[model samples]
Target chain A: GESVGLHLPTLSVQEGDNSIINCAYSNSASDYFIWYKQESGKGPQFIIDIRSNMDKRQGQRVTVLLNKTVKHLSLQIAATQPGDSAVYFCAERGAGAQKLVFGQGTRLTINP
Target chain B: NAGVTQTPKFRILKIGQSMTLQCAQDMNHNYMYWYRQDPGMGLKLIYYSVGAGITDKGEVPNGYNVSRSTTEDFPLRLELAAPSQTSVYFCASSRGQPISYEQYFGPGTRLTVT
Candidate 1:
């Protein structure tokens, strides 16, 4: 995932609402993508991931959708709660390479 | 397991001072990575190692050096500190390579260069 500068820095969502955060990547060579969540002053934690061949993948309460045609990636948090509040980042990895390219990051604030 | 751990949560360095950031992983991961995160910016890869004794540079590797002498340790070196080098540094490791595997990260080390 890529950010020209800093576009979506913050996102506010109600406790029970489903939140959608968007990300765009510049490198088309990226074949695998993943989402990460980082709490204040903490390290980024893996959320979900999807391969280029597939368009969508889901996990516990999160879903990741990849649009290779548009070079877009998005993460959907179902029933966002205060516990889910954190900075969400999208990452991309090239085929057969372990290094990942990270997105700027969007701070997801779950309002109670 | 402590997953991944980094030493010196914070540090302040002078323009020409040099220091090393230490990273250790307990999962015995074959792949390890070092990244720097600037305020309001994405994490930029500095260097990575697939296994012990192998190392390579990533997107923004300028002025940064790394050594992976052990399977569990990856250290980042800065010879001459610069204001531009101030940022939060992270170390991560994973059992999978190239394709995919959940990467576990350390708390991070915040650095300040005056």
Candidate 2:
């Protein structure tokens, strides 16, 4: 079975500071990776995604870096805001897998 | 498009009870899925359907059953609810294969079984 894991369970950062959440996947064949932001009492929202062919991808104020060599993925948030306070999760899908496997998730707290 | 909608936003079931969670999508997507989220745990796939009349079990399909009689609806059935089945359930749909396509999720249905 494939397992996705996050390095940090919780991260606290001051507003306007950069926040990085790390994730590691066990399957090397996993090619598709996605970052999701789940706010309190809501379903997870898609942040961004990267394919194995690409090492990096960026969204409005977020960036996802994929390091297939080390089976690692990271999401970077710029100028974190109070609205960004939520649980972030990284999910991976193997080449021919039917569904994605999600990590435990990292709780991000933004300090005012 | 009302991308994905789930009925019974909140439900409380007693032990040995049976109930169904309803999910409907207007996007006319071919892929639909059901997942459960537990406290401090990631979302676990319960069931998925590639198209109408084609349903399959996912990672955590033990206590659940699903049917995709129509392309727009996929309902999950719990035969005998248990405390372990208490969790938030989400319904999602994608335009294409899940491996390469993005899935849109609904608000979710919070279920509590005692």
Candidate 3:
């Protein structure tokens, strides 16, 4: 009965501002967590990932923070742009698991 | 590299129809996976394969079957399509074992079952 879920179903942010998308996972055994971005009419693309051992990981203009104690994960995008509009999903995989469990996803819209 | 590729970008099928969803990867990855994305929802695992000739059922594998004959191909077959089977199907691949979590996804095939 493992489940990964997001805090919000939809989020709107100013184009030049920062955006944060949160996720809460139920499986404490999950050791790996990933953030994926899905643009319209396309498959989900890998954004960033963090392991339970690490608290945060950064890439380009994005950052992923993992709070294992609270079973929460977050993806932060700096200087959000129009191109950042998409559905963002968080997925988790337990140790030695062959597949990942994905959350329902958050629709992130960048406002001008 | 072409990465992961799936055939039939879009399809419409009648209930009880059968079809095969083709997936191929040129990256020479040992791990392949099939996932279905429902509207306003996330992706659900249908099946997965680790290397050629090795297949396993995933979280949602009730109406689907998969075969991994070669490292490059892993096809998912639908025996009797139903309305609930309509969704966007994505194929993904990654290096198996120690480095298996960072997956590369395909463009996806949208199927509508009426």
Candidate 4:
């Protein structure tokens, strides 16, 4: 059975600070990992992704770190802002798999 | 380009009723998928199509059916709505294998069965 899980269900961060959301995946064969941001009543939007071959990948203001050794994944938001307030989800795809296994999202709240 | 569009933004159906959730994508993507999102839960794949005239069952395909007549359209059908079928349905598309390509999701259709 393949499973993706988040470390925290909710995270509150002050504006301008940094936020780190952790995820754990069970499948060792999974090579592709993605982080998505879902706003209220909207579909999940792609944020960033890291392949198992890469340890780190960065986007505009977000970074995705993949630790294949521990089967852990994480998304870091630098200078978090109010607009970053949304539910974040981590998804993983095993080799030759057609679908992604999503983790229960973590609600990110940006506090003033 | 309307990347992906799903009709009937919201719908309320009675038990035993039937309906189709229409999905269309203009990206010319070869792979399309149907997923359901329960409250406080993650998305579960119900069905997927690799290309036109080709469809396959996903992790949660029960109580639903799908058709891919064209590369741009994939519709999900519920033979008989049930209370457990009440959830947000999303349609997604990707150019190729998900292992390398990212999926683009639609706004989603909120279906409630009473």
Candidate 5:
């Protein structure tokens, strides 16, 4: 089955440093991608999203970069804080599909 | 707005038991979804509803069922629960087309099957 996967299962970063998480997807028909953050005992929270037509999108403190040619995506967080530590996941939506497929996820740990 | 709300934050069900996980969103969104998260893994979609009375299966829809009777409620039903079914369940809703991809999630229901 075609699925989305992360480059690393866990990432350790120091406070105030920038962090990047990478994901690879096999579905070329996907036209939309999204990033989500999930904390302990909570559901996934929406972070940012990008369309296949555009290569990059930015939020307040987060940025999502999409590479359609390589079927890859990345989420970058600037000036990582303790609150930014959580499990991050990348999801993709196939064309005309109502459900989004999710990647394995990367646990981002911030050391203060 | 409460955004999305789910009942029974935690539960322990014995084998062969059955239960329905309730999910309701006050946003009145047109789309709803159900997903399960296992330990150290990402979410697997169980089922999804495009709108009231329209439902469809997702990546992993076995051992689960869902129905959308109203615009705000989408409940997931599990019959003859098994140990493998022990996981955290989440309900989410979105307002726009699939391209929008902005989903609001509920707190989640944690279930343990013995």
Candidate 6:
């Protein structure tokens, strides 16, 4: 079975600081990976995604890094804002449109 | 498009009771899914459908059931609700098929079972 996991349980960073959340997946067959931001009392929102062929991908203020060799993925937010505070999750899809295995999640808090 | 929409923003169930979580999408997506979120555990796939008349169990399908009667709707049913079934539920939809599909989520439904 494919599983996604996060390295940190919680992280607090001062406003305007960069925040990096790490994720590790066990499924090497997974070709697509996504990062989602889930706030309190809300569903997870798509943040960004990376393909196995690509080593990195970037979105609005976010970046997703994929290291196929280590089966690791990460999300980096530049100049993190208060709105960036949420539970960050990493999800992996193994070649079908069926379901995505989600990570345990990392709570990101931006301190002002 | 309104994307994916789920009914009953919140629900409370008693032991041995049953309830259904409704899910609908206007994007004409063929793929739909149900997931449950628990504290620190993230989201676990409960059930999913590829198209109308097609449905399958996911990682944690026990105590839950799902049906896709139309292309736009996929509803999850809880036969006998239990305390362990208490959690936030989310409905998501994707375009589906042989390509890499990105999922859009609904607001969510918070269900509490006692």
Give Cα-based local distance difference scores for all models.
0.87, 0.92, 0.94, 0.95, 0.93, 0.90
Q: Which stretches of candidate 4 lie above 4 Å from their native place?
A: none
Model 6 chain B: worst 10 consecutive residues (lDDT sum) = B94-103
Better of 1 and 4 by lDDT: 4
TM-score of chain B of each: 0.96, 0.96, 0.97, 0.97, 0.97, 0.96
Please estimate how well model 5 matches the true structure, expressed as its whole-model Cα lDDT.
0.93
Range of the 10 consecutive residues with the lowest summed lDDT in candidate 1 chain A: A1-10
Writing each residue's lDDT as its tens digit, candidate 1 over B15-63 gives 9999999999998899899999998777888998989999998888998
* Candidate 2 C-alpha lDDT tens digits along A2-95: 9999999999999999999999999999989999999999888999999899999999999999998899999999999999999999999888
Q: Backbone collision count in every prediction?
A: 2, 0, 0, 0, 0, 0
Cα lDDT of model 5 by residue, B78-114, tens digit? 9999999999999999996833558999999999999
In candidate 4, what are the lDDT values of residues A1-112, reduced to their tens digit? 8999999999999999999999999999998999999999999999998888999999999999999999999999999999999999999988888778899999999999
Q: Of the candidates numbered 4 and 5, which has the greater lDDT value? A: 4
iRMS, candidate 6, in Å: value is 1.1
Please, what are the lDDT tens digits per residue for candidate 2 over residues B4-112? 9998999999999999999999998999999999988889999999899999989889989999999999999999999999999999988766434678899999999
Off by over 4 Å in 2: B98-100
Q: What is every candidate's C-alpha DockQ against the true complex, given to 2 decimals? A: 0.83, 0.79, 0.85, 0.84, 0.88, 0.81
Flag regions of model 5 displaced more than 4 Å.
Answer: none
Which candidate should be chosen as best, given DockQ against the real structure? 5
lDDT of 5 at A41: 88
